[model samples]
Target: MNKETNYQKALHCYIQASLNILNHFRSSVKEIHHIGSTSIEHMDLPGEVDVLLLVKDEGDLSKLADHVRGVGYDEVEDFSTGYIEEVVLRHRYDGYDVNFIMMHHKSKRKDEILYCRNRLQGSEKYLERFRQLKAAYQNEHINGDEYQVKKSDLFSSVMNMQGDADVV
Candidate 1:
């Protein structure tokens, strides 16, 4: 499928997943954000919808994890260096992979997450830079650690420039 087609499919999957999450979590989640490659328009398609689920507090993390598993989401064992204690859950929705990143409402990485998404959504320069990085190291199985660090640095550099190092 073409980029537009892939984006459309990914978006459809995000909407479906978002609705299901809302129906299931309801008041437990403070906010739900559509993030990552699929959320950015004109960016290279990853075909996976990355959802940020901000719960009201740290206590909700375990609850959400249990809820996700009960609802059929498998916990993805991510080896990437994590900036915070966040829960990563994955499930296939309409053939597209939907990743749910559950974190506390006051997590330090919250701004970074929103900033990255907003930057990519609004600025073509940053988006192209990100696209180039992803194009070079999209195949993670071959260069997992390197790819993760570089991707993290890409965001960290952007955050650092704006004096948002607390989250990096």
Candidate 2:
């Protein structure tokens, strides 16, 4: 019998998803980055791939969202924040829940997100610790806005571990 795992996906699946988005967004997208737990080697994930897409500051997000949804990708509207908005898209590809973040090239938050990912990949010890924190959060039954807030907290903790960490 073939069983599907609820959480965790092969790293390459996430990579391909990023590539696909990159291709679709081509000239408009400056770059696409792989992030989240899945981006960290050998780490258990919730089958969700977090990808960051860098676009021009004036990029039309609604159009992009419509385009991605037209192509059969799921849109995650729950990820936007006030002051600085980030468009997040999700899709289940090859059993992986892939998420794409549409961000502007000059956004400070974009740099912070990239920094957090780098920090996570830099230390095996810290990565394992973060895995545990994520595992514990799974049992907390958090949802929507709270989940996003908690995720920010997780990133902050991870960055702080590296000492003198910046925003996350």
Candidate 3:
């Protein structure tokens, strides 16, 4: 199948899975958000859709996991933090893979979120540099292995320039 068709199918499956989970815990979940590459527009061959289901209390997590299993999703594993528990689910449909990650409200990492948002919204120069590197890698204009090495250096340089390393 063509790339576009594949992406559309993946998106459909993601939305369905998300809705299923949401309906299962409509009363307990405070919010459900679609994050990561799949949520970004024009992204082709995305690894997988990352869904964050935020609940108000940690005790509600087990109920959410049970609800997901009841909806035909196999429970892959559980990830825990001091304030929340994340239940991971994986299922396949028509050779496509879908993943669901249910997290509690307290699990939200504010620092990481803010850092990523800042990087994406930073100065034009940084954005342009990132775009160029991305285009090179996407267009196969450079060796993948070489790009990986250079990309790390690019990130380090950008971080240093922004003094992000000093930020707590």
Candidate 4:
């Protein structure tokens, strides 16, 4: 009777999927993380699961993409950056937004990714503030693209505030 059951279930499956992706590119990817709304504890979240794939060299990205596609995750063109080439994959697992953010190990952008989440999750006040914003946005009944635009604006600002000098 838990309404959050599906969220938890999907998150569990998504984390497992992230582990599988890490296994697929274990040689290149040293550390893989599950970070995002779903990664936040006690936070109401959607079905999207953002994954961080930290590469050791980031030299052979094509091979990694090929291997990712070979594992049934079709590459979706999203999250392309100047330094980091993000290769998000789409799988038919009940419409889960599984993002594969490929970045160099110990890169600034990589650190930023975790830092953004950690900062919000670190403080209950901030977390509740963000949760309220999310609820307000949802109440507005906006489309997904619009919702993403708003979230992107917020997250981009947060990351920018976290010292935009070195982003992995």
Candidate 5:
């Protein structure tokens, strides 16, 4: 199939996955956003979706963990930004790998996450830079962690340039 066909398929799968999660946690979540490369238009990605789930209260973290686990999402990790907590869960939905990131509504990390996503969405220059990085990572065949670190570094640099503190 052609690249556009592949991208269309991936985008469809991503949206379906997002809807499934949104429906599952309709009452528990404050907001849900499509983040990461899959959310960016024309960005080439394997069928994976990054979802950001904001909860109304901090106490909802454990409840969400249980809720997601009951529905087949495995707890990927528990991470934080010193003052705020974030939980990551992963599951396969409709042939798409979905990374569900849950955080409290008050977490400052949310701003950073949205900012990075919006930056990529708003600027072809930033998007092209990210694409180049992804290409080089694929060419080198590095592990996923290494690729994440490189992406984080690139994002951190961008955030710093805008006078924001480094997030990753």
Candidate 6:
């Protein structure tokens, strides 16, 4: 399939997954967001959809995961950073990946949802810098070695901007 078709398929999977979660666990989840590269338009395939599942409490995280799995998503792995539980799921039909991150109401880590949204709303200079870096990296304007260096720098700059926000 073409890149556009693949992206649409992935997006459909994301919508389905979000609806499924909301239908089953609406009370526990405070917010469900579609984040990461796929959330940004005109970007190449990032191969997965990153979801941020914010909840009022962390005690019901396992229940949430079970509900997601019950809806035909297979759990691939789980990660915990003392503040949140990150549950990775892969859809059986399309193999599209989704991350169900369970975050407590109180956490110091930068909020992924706010970070992504803020970055997108950042100044034109910041956006232009990112665009130039992305284009150069994608088009092989810079060699492989230079691409890695430049990519890291670009990412750090974006992260720094996002980090300035209050996470709550």
Best prediction by TM-score: 1
lDDT of 2 by residue, 36-71 (tens): 777776565564677887776455566776788899
Deviation (Å) of 79 in candidate 3: 9.1
Candidate 5 lDDT over residue span 94-121, tens digit each: 6777778888877778888888777666
Q: How accurate is candidate 2 locally (lDDT)?
A: 0.70
lDDT of 1 by residue, 2-69 (tens): 44566677877888998998998887889888888778768746657888889997888898789889
**Alpha-carbon lDDT, every model:** 0.77, 0.70, 0.59, 0.67, 0.73, 0.62
TM-score ranking, high to low: 1, 5, 2, 4, 6, 3
TM-scores of the candidates are: 0.84, 0.74, 0.57, 0.74, 0.80, 0.61
**Tens-digit lDDT string for candidate 3 (122-164):** 5467556655775687678987676666666665565556545
In order, what is each prediction's RMSD in angstroms? Answer: 3.6, 4.3, 6.8, 4.2, 4.1, 5.7
Where does model 5 exceed 4 Å of error? Answer: 1-7, 78-84, 162-168
Model 2 lowest lDDT segment of ten: 3-12
- The C-alpha local distance difference test score for the whole of candidate 5 amounts to 0.73
Query: How well does candidate 6 score on lDDT at residue 146?
Result: 74
Put down candidate 4 lDDT per residue, 1-168, tens digits, no spaces.
656564586677677777676666677777888776777776765646777777777675667777778878877664433333565666655466677766677677777778878776665666775676566665776665666676666676665554344333
Q: Which stretches of candidate 3 lie over 4 Å from their true place?
A: 1-10, 78-85, 93-95, 110-168
TM-score of 1: 0.84
- C-alpha RMSD in Å of predicted model 1 compared with the true structure: 3.6
